[model samples]
Target: MNLDDDIALAHALADAAGAVIRPYFRARFVQEAKADASPVTQADREAEEAIRALIEEHRAGDGIIGEEYGAARADAERVWVLDPIDGTRAFIGGRPIFGTLIALMIEGHPVLGVIDQPISSERWIGAAGRPTRFNGKPAGTRACPELSRALFATTAPWFCGGFEALRSAAGDTLLGGDCYNYALLASGHGDLVVEEGLKLHDWAALLPVVEGAGGRMTDWHGQSLHKGSDGRVVAVGDPALLPQVLELLER
Candidate 1:
């Protein structure tokens, strides 16, 4: 499939997964703890299963790496990375910040991405070499220039190695999870988002969205992100501001 077709397929998949997850938002459900002590609910598993099923049926030869179910069909050149419900804690607590994240990674680089927030009725899609869009209209990142004027965000304060330094740099901070912060960054509503303690599924889908919207998405070390990375994720609106922040972290 061509890039547009692939991006369309990803959007469809994200919409389908959102359909499965939206009903559970703000509704009480059985919540359980994973071995890692993170919370999981029927919504999380069911949404992931739904997305995986779509990928398996529609792109049978492609591999998948999902947050809830782990990896499947690992050797395919094109892989679908999924985070069915990126902000489970927010979902469980009746917050609308949660969303479904999906991406197509071809030969290890994210080329297409979708972040669907059903509650807000917002969907952001991005593909390599194409403009980023929100519900089909073009979108771009905010134009914050320096740390002193930037609005930084993260899932929590403790996730990044340079949390103290970043907090000190930004004019304001928005504490939240992956997809929500990514959406804000893409919409020109937030300037920077730093995430640490992430798996490939968490960051993979976000790379295309951030980059396509004229922003930078990379590990804290100023290196490109990969499936094997476990360091902090630093996303920023202006590419010019990223290296400065990265250098601060490296100090």
Candidate 2:
């Protein structure tokens, strides 16, 4: 498949997700818990359905793995990963930090990804072998050589058991930004973001975005993250800080 065309489709998929998600943001949409006890709402289902429609229209042979809808066509060579709202808790709490994550996975690796924030009208697209862009302009990250000098963030502290250590290592740890935290890291607003319990859909799109913007992300073991990763995450805006940051988090 032509990656350029797939990137465009990823962007459009993100847009489709937003069209359904915006109306329900902070609005009373019936929410229920999945078997995992995570929240799922009409917005999530509707958004994934919308994206699925677009993919079916464009790449019917491709597969899908979504938060709301489980995997489909699991053996396909190409797959689309969707997390309609990467920060559903923030969305339910009326915060705009939540985002729609869309990724095009080829043979279990993300080749194109997009993080779309409907409320803010912001979008970040990162495609392998291409420069990352924030709202169509080149976006790059700032470098911070030391962990203590870094501004760090995470979806929340309690999600990770070693949160206190990570906070101590960074000098400061701010809570609650989900995918926005990664976007912040990509845009150079935050230096690092760490989280645990992320699924493939949760971190796949952010991986290329972070790395494309002169940043890097990996599982806690400092190995490259792939479809089967266990979901312990560490993302850094400056690649130089990855080792020390991983050292602290892993310890």
Candidate 3:
């Protein structure tokens, strides 16, 4: 398979999702509570449908794991993981930090990922063996060797363990950026991101985006993230901070 072809398809998928999402931003819409009590809106469902439709038309054989819709052909060798609106709360609150997350998993490993912020029209695409790009320009993380000098980001404190310790250790902290935090980290805007309770669709797309931009992402235990990860994830713009971050997380 031509990797470029797949990468192009990934961009198209993001475009499709963005098109569906832009109209709903800050517009009147009803939000419903899911079984897990998380918010879901029409934009989330419609955007995922748009993305799934494009994947079906172009890559019919591939599997799909979506946030709104359940899995289809999940055992296939190649699967697409999608989260139409990763930060529904932020989206509902008219915040632009929510993003559309898309990832192509080949044989259970993510090979490409896209994080698209529809309202801002900022896109970050990352593929294995290639530099990450933000709006067609190469994006990279900055060097911050120590946690005390890092700018930390997370959506909420409840999703993280040792939140107070880590927050206090970091040089600066900003809250509420959902998947966009990873995009910022990839673009040298942030230094660290740590969160828990993320689903595959929530984080699968982040691995490639973070890793391809001179950053590292792993579980709280410092293991590689995979389909079975426990949802505790930590991302650092500089890998040197991982050990220190992990130590504080264990406290």
Candidate 4:
């Protein structure tokens, strides 16, 4: 398969999904929950359905694993991992930090990823062997040499066990959800993004974006993430800073 062609398609799909989601964002809407107790909104379901329909029409054989509606067509070698609205809480609160996340996994590895923040008109896209870009400009992680200078973001304090260690290492901290933090990390704005309780959809779309931007991402144990991860993710711009943060967290 031509990876670039696939990545471009993924980027277009993400943008389409974002357009479907942007209108209902923060608007009056009903809220509900999934079996796992995560919040779901009208925007979430609508966006997922729109994206699913588009994917089915264009790539009939590809599988899809979505946050709002669950997995479908799971046997295909190329699967799309999607979080229709990565930061639902932020979206509900009228914050523009929320985004639409889409990732293509071949075999068991992510090959292309896109994070579209419709509210801000910002799009980040990356592929395994291609350059990462933000709104069509090449982007990369910052060059922070030490942990003390790193800016960190986490979904929440309760989600991860290594908060204290991260706090100790990072001079500043910001709280946010899902792909937004990863978007910031890839755009050279944030130095590190660490979280726990992540699912495949949460980190899959983000892996290529981070790695393509000269950063590193893995589970807490420093293992490469897969479709069945236990929901822990640690990402940083500089490779040198990763081991130090990992060592501190593991301690």
The TM-score values for the models, in the order shown, are 0.96, 0.97, 0.98, 0.96
Q: Which TM-score value belongs to model 1? A: 0.96
Q: Enumerate residue pairs that collide in model 3.
A: none
Please give, for residues 90-135, the per-residue lDDT of candidate 2 as tens digits: 8888999899999888888888889889999999999998889999
Report how far residue 111 has shifted in candidate 3, in Å.
1.0
Cα distance off (Å), candidate 3, residue 28: 1.6
- Model 3 Cα lDDT, one tens digit per residue, 107-163: 788889999998988999999999999999999999999999999999889988889
* Residue range 112-179, candidate 1, lDDT tens digits: 88888988899888888988899889999978888899998888887767878888888988887657
RMSD of 4: 1.3
Worst 10 residues of 3 by lDDT: 22-31
Pick the lDDT winner: 3
The residue-by-residue lDDT of candidate 4 on 44-157, one tens digit each, is 888888888888988889999998788888778999988888888888889898888899998878988899999889999988877799999998998997999999888788
Global CA lDDT computed for model 4: 0.86
Q: Which 10 residues in a row give candidate 1 its minimum summed lDDT?
A: 225-234
Summing lDDT over every window of 10 consecutive residues in candidate 4, give the lowest-scoring window.
3-12
Q: Quote the lDDT for 223 in model 1.
A: 86
Instruction: Show model 4 residue runs off by greater than 4 Å.
Output: none
Superior by lDDT: candidate 1 or candidate 2: 2
